[model samples]
Target: MSIGETPARPRKKKKHTGRNIILSVVALIVIAGLVAGGYLWNLGRTFDSNSSKITDAFPAEETRPEVKEESKDAINILLLGTDTREVRSDETEEDEFATLPGGGRSDTMMLVHIPSDRKNVFVTSIMRDTWLDIPGVGTAKINRAFASGGVPKAVETLEGLFGIRINHVASIDFEGFKGMTDAVGGVTINNPIAFRPVHNKSYYFPEGEQKLNGEEALAFVRERKAFTGAGGSDYRRVKNQQLFVKAILGQILSKETLTSPAKIQGIVQEMAPYVAVDESLDATKVAGIASSMLNIRSSDMEFFTLPNNGPGRSADGQSIVIPDMDTIEKFGEALQRDTVDQFVASTDLSK
Candidate 1:
């Protein structure tokens, strides 16, 4: 069977809405993994049994990078947030069927790299529109990897780009993002600069510390049209995503959240139905992975974007982000050698 043929479930075509853009559904999985411990037995079992499982979501082993003995204990997880909703009535056919795969483009792609020592967790966000080569397809936007061949193509494209062996993969539905925020009783983030978005003009976000409910939080991370100028939209959007993730982490680690078993349980159970992970990451494996990172705290996580040249037009006139390949090449080498700290320090990761 073709790699993309392994179905998680039948796709139900939902109408396109402003909330279609998912920001941190996969990040919730990472949070779940970090929180897993003696308490994780139930979380793991609940998550494993309730969530969908993607069969054969990875490419052939021969084509993947081998983990160096020195970095044997390190893990790289590809976290993707996808939207399968149909295009709006006003959209063109090209917009609706722009890619081969029916699962739709991955709205968010983050590589969560956990070093062997587990002292720090690094998250590198890959711009969805970064022009890159997709396996079995010519060069195109990196997001197209998911749209063209589902999880396997997305995995293959990333491995080929970073030369890193992905230990696991996870995709989450956008609805999970809202459920998780509500389950945690909401998250607060300090807004650096804010404005009302075009989609929802009535929702005014002032510049200051802001407390956001589930629906408002979704709008906060997904607003790009409010940022004017070329390249400004995605640049600010990515930063918002990182900031929101950090806030969620803080809330999760807070006394209120940690002390309340009901809250944590609510988060896992509420989010489980919207998540899908590789077949290998079953209950036992998820719990094991989580237990190993039990020492991880919100302060230890570092989030940054993969360096990219400023936004520009493609040869065909489509707007795209030019990746900094030279730096990316070195980044790949660091992943293999487990010297990402050194690489991150020396590299100019400015977008």
Candidate 2:
């Protein structure tokens, strides 16, 4: 046979190589499973078993004594920051400066609303000194509700004051706040003025964007006198708090911080332990809430203190914040409908 003819003698049948195809199929399946697992895990953690009980406190017209699908969608959470300087279980002697039971007060109170649609989250900070009705306790300082009966009383006070249903409550102690700030490395704030803290004598930051560590961040938020200038007071301080929150949020949502697993884990661990959620919430659930809020940009979140005419002495002789009822009612109406524009319009900064 000719050499060419012999070579052409049927090339040995090439066996179909299925190995690569099989490996590819296996890889796809594994990826799909991981994606599905992650989704399920997140969903399962979004709402805890006791969600109903905790949410029952806030009664929507449609949700009260009845079941409604729409009512389930909108959620309002009360964020309370207590001053527990003296109530430490490990402490033998009460520090004169401790705020909790013996000395401390509620330094900050914020109401966070996460709409059912998950479009954006709205946060409103209530000045701790705002005197309002405390349900069964009658009228009193808002911060005292925590000391009188812990979170339950505080929730009652908020429900009475705002006439809105607060679905959940989350309390984070001071140490947790510090740790969270540290975990995120630090937060940046725009300091338009410079001053010093009366209590700590720490140097205040100048007007500009400043990176703040845990301690400095805490001081910044709590520094009323410095931010208010000669007339520095809680009103200005609350505004600054709102600004600080926005800055912290900006830092947190930045690509550099959110994408880093190690940093994220550190933040989660440090924050989770110090947080006390209503019986309904846990770390996983809170994480889901945070995830849902990822879409709310720093600019989208607007902050305003309750409009007040001035500080006045109550019949009991104690100082009290006199809220502009007309404006406050309008703000409440806006909150009920989840409209930021209405709320912002009702606020006249000129006061």
Which segments of candidate 1 are over 4 A away from where they belong? 1-39, 84-86, 89-104
Ten consecutive residues with minimal summed lDDT in candidate 2? Answer: 93-102
How close is each model in CA RMSD to the real structure? 17.3, 7.9
Candidate 2, residues 259-328, lDDT tens digits: the string is 6756765666666655556666664666667767767777776666666766777788876677677776
Candidate 2: deviation at residue 316, Å? Answer: 2.4
- The candidate that achieves the highest TM-score relative to the unseen native structure: 1
Output the lDDT of residue 129, model 1. Answer: 84
- Off-target runs (Cα >4 Å) in candidate 2 are 1-72, 86-104, 225-231, 345-351
**How many clashes in candidate 1?**
0
For candidate 1, which ten residues in a row score worst on lDDT? 12-21
Error at 55, model 2, angstroms? 14
How well is each residue in 17-123 modelled by candidate 1, as lDDT tens digits?
22343435566766765665556777777887789877888988887877688788999998876555555575344344323223543567789999998888899
